[model samples]
Target: MSALTGTTRLARLVLRRDRIRLAIWILGTPLLGYALAGSVASIYPGQEARLGYATTSASSLVARAFNGPIHGTDLGAVVVAETYVTLALIVALLSTFAVTRHTRQNEETGRAELLGANVVGRYAPLTAALLVIVAANTLAAVLLAVALAGAGLPLAGSVAAAAAIGGVGVAFTAIAAVTAQLSVTARGANALAAATVGLAFVLRAAGDVLGEQSADGTRVRSAWPSWISPLGWGNQVRAFDGERWWVLALPVALLLVGVALAYALAERRDQGAGLIAPRRGPATAAPRLLSPAGLAWRMQRGTLLGWAVGVAVLGFSMGIAGDEFNDMIDANPAAAEAINAMGGGADLINAYLAAMLGLFALTIGAYVVQALLRVRGDEADGVLEAALATAVSRTRWLGTQVLAATLGAVALLLVAGVTTGLGYGIVTGDPLGQAVELGGAALLRLPALLVIAGVVTAIFGLLPRWSVVLSWTALLVFLLLGQLGAVLELPQAALNVSPYTHVPAVPAVDPAALPLVVLAAVAAALLAVGVAAFRHRDVPS
Candidate 1:
């Protein structure tokens, strides 16, 4: 059989395996764009209103960091500016997970060995994975363009924006492909890919923040910084204001170069091995390192550090953003009300800090999910069984991972809170006070986070096979509810599903004792049930 013999079959298999996942990615991006554009049109109906909003956003460094430059006062440009960065991020993430799931994850699970024993080509699995991602991006682009135009955006701009978003997804797919070849473990591969995405975001944010704009507000930013980063290229497309179509070429070029490199590296390495070999461990395993808790820590340290750095940087930068945000709220009444609602009180700065903590609390869920899911990971790899072979009881072995996840979560939350306080305090001329307030604000959301962590723990213990899926699905639901529930006009019941909704936006309002106590009780009960279930179940091979 030819080297690409089973490519078509594998492609079909991938489609079957990821049907729900693909639907989520392909549909979610365009739908969000539609929602954002429709909301922009509704909220800022008049040109003057839109222009005022744009001007306020332009002056705020925080706005510029998150959303790219605004080119025109037209509704189209407003939508593009508001949605492009966030959409690109979502698409990039979709592509990253899709590739990593099919390629690296399969190999790590030993499924690739079974497939390779058949008529499958050596490269067919990777090829099939890329093809699926490419198809998903293509469909998303078409759907996004249609959705935008259907929503009354200009046709040319709609197509340009959709295509640009697709470019991000495609480029990340190639990046993931390369990273998969380098890392022996799926987690390592995901880390490397995630790091690339993080760097791209920072580079783009830096470029937009530092770039000197010409008087016309015509030249949005310094294109040089954007030129170096693949994700940044999507924003430069200038979809509504004389499209810079040349920018899309960057990701295309990256896809080609990255794939070629991946293939070459694959050729040089043996199946089931990484391009770079892992280092030899200590001649003797340390007694301290042999415990389950120690092992969990060892597995989690890198991830903890990575997340801490990102959150700290975000907090510090947001703290500095207070000056501009204050100026912004003074000029925009709409912004002030929004901040007021989130927890900054009548003082817009405090409201901004309160909002940041809430948002940061949501982001922390990603880490919590990853940490707790180590239970499922260990089980899948038979590590749990081997560890259980010792004098360790099942509950104790599993409890170590749960404990690590909880304690690690607390540490990360404090880091985020303290950093937010420090950054906001220093910028606002009251470092100590702001730090205490914001740090408390961060801790305010702990009960909510614990509920989430407990939910994941419960899922792992009770539904070993479905744990990863159900737990992550819950996390997504909570995240969407916290971030977009109000704007989407979701039902009270839906909003109540997320524990975060119960946590008071601190500093803006006084902390309430009742909600936290109730949330804690729920989490404790769920975790206990999950642990109990795990004890009696047979371990799946």
Candidate 2:
């Protein structure tokens, strides 16, 4: 049989299996662009306002680092600038997860071996996965273009913007295809791809921040670093301005090179093996392996460290940008009102910090869910059964996992708070005072984070099979509600459903002890119910 004998059939299978998940990424990603376009149009309705934004943002290194270089002062160009970096990053992740889910995940679970016993060929799975992901990216591009135009952006700019977003996604899809062949397991493949994406963003951001700006402060010619990254190429497309269609050739070239490399690597590796083999563990178990808590910590420490670094970077960026943002807000009342809605205080700087901190809470919520879901991963892998055969009780094993997750969450928050304060303090020459204040404000978010942990645990206990999908979905819903509830003008009842809504917007509003107490009680109750339910459920193995 040919190496790609079953590519078509396998592609169909991938779509059938991942329809809902793919649908969410495809539809939801573009929806964010649509929302941002509408919000930007409303905020900067006039040419003068757009120019003001261009001038202020162009001169601010922090703004340029976050948003990339400004293309033009037009409404369409502004929308592209606002949404491209974030949307491209999102869709890039979408591609990675999709590729790894179909390729490495199938191999890890032995489904690939089972299929290979039949009519499937050697290269069929990889080819099929790539085909499906490419198709999905194409569909996402079309939808994003339509969404942008529907939001009243120019058609040409909208198409350019969508192509950039989709180009980044496709480029990353190829990267993931290669990473899948390099890693032994799906998790490793995803982590490698994610790290690559992070590097791309940093490169793009660095290039933009270091680039020279025009005399009018409306355009920047990015440095060489931007030219090397796919994200940078996407940005260089200059959507809604001159629209450099040739810039897109860069990603297309990378995609071709990456695909060829992935196929070559695949041929070198044995089935179910990787080009980069996992290191051998010591012959003996460490003493820490004896305890459930220790094992839990060992399992989760790496993820915690990764997230801690992410939040620290976030906090530092926010801190450095705080004072400048206050001035920006003062200059733009419409933007100020939106920022204030997150959690405004008498001090505009404090308000900005509070709003950013609240956003961080949503981000940390994702980590919380992922950490807690380690329990589900263990259960799915049938490792729980082996561990349970020893002296460990179900409750202890599960509770230890929860404890690890909680402590990790706390550490992440503390790190964020301290780093934010540190960055601001370094700028203001009052590090200690700012660290204490921002650190405290960051800790104030703990109750809301705990609620998310409880929710994930509950889902794992009650619906083991659905735990992964449901847990992430729950987090996404909470995130949307927390970030956009006010912007969307949803009802008070709907907003209150998100635990983040109940948390005091620290520094912006005074902390209320009662609400904190109530949230804690709710979290405790959920944890108890989840633990109790998990104790009664059958181990799926």
Per model, how many backbone clashes are there? 2, 0
Per-candidate local distance difference test: 0.82, 0.87
Error of 1 at 276 (Å): 1.7
lDDT of 1 by residue, 216-305 (tens): 443456457766877778878888888888888888888899888888888888888898677788998878687777788888888888
Q: What is candidate 2's lDDT per residue for 1-541, written digit by digit as tens?
A: 9999999999999999988888888898778788878878877888877887888788889988889888879998888777788888888988998999999999999999998999988889999999999889989999999999999988998999999999998999999999999999999999999999999999999999999999878888899899988899888999988899998887788888988999899889899999898989999998998999888888888888899988999799889887687667766776776777777667667777888888888888888888888788788888999999999998998989888888988898888889898888888899899999989998999999888888888888898888887888888888778877776678989998899988888888898999899999999988988999999999978
TM-score to native of every candidate shown: 0.94, 0.97
Candidate 1 lDDT:
0.82
Best by lDDT: 2
- For residue 532, model 1's alpha carbon misses the true position, in angstroms, by 2.3
Superposed model 2: Cα runs more than 4 Å off: none
- On TM-score, the leading prediction is 2
lDDT of model 1 at residue 135? 93
Q: Model 2 Cα displacement at 212 (Å)?
A: 1.7
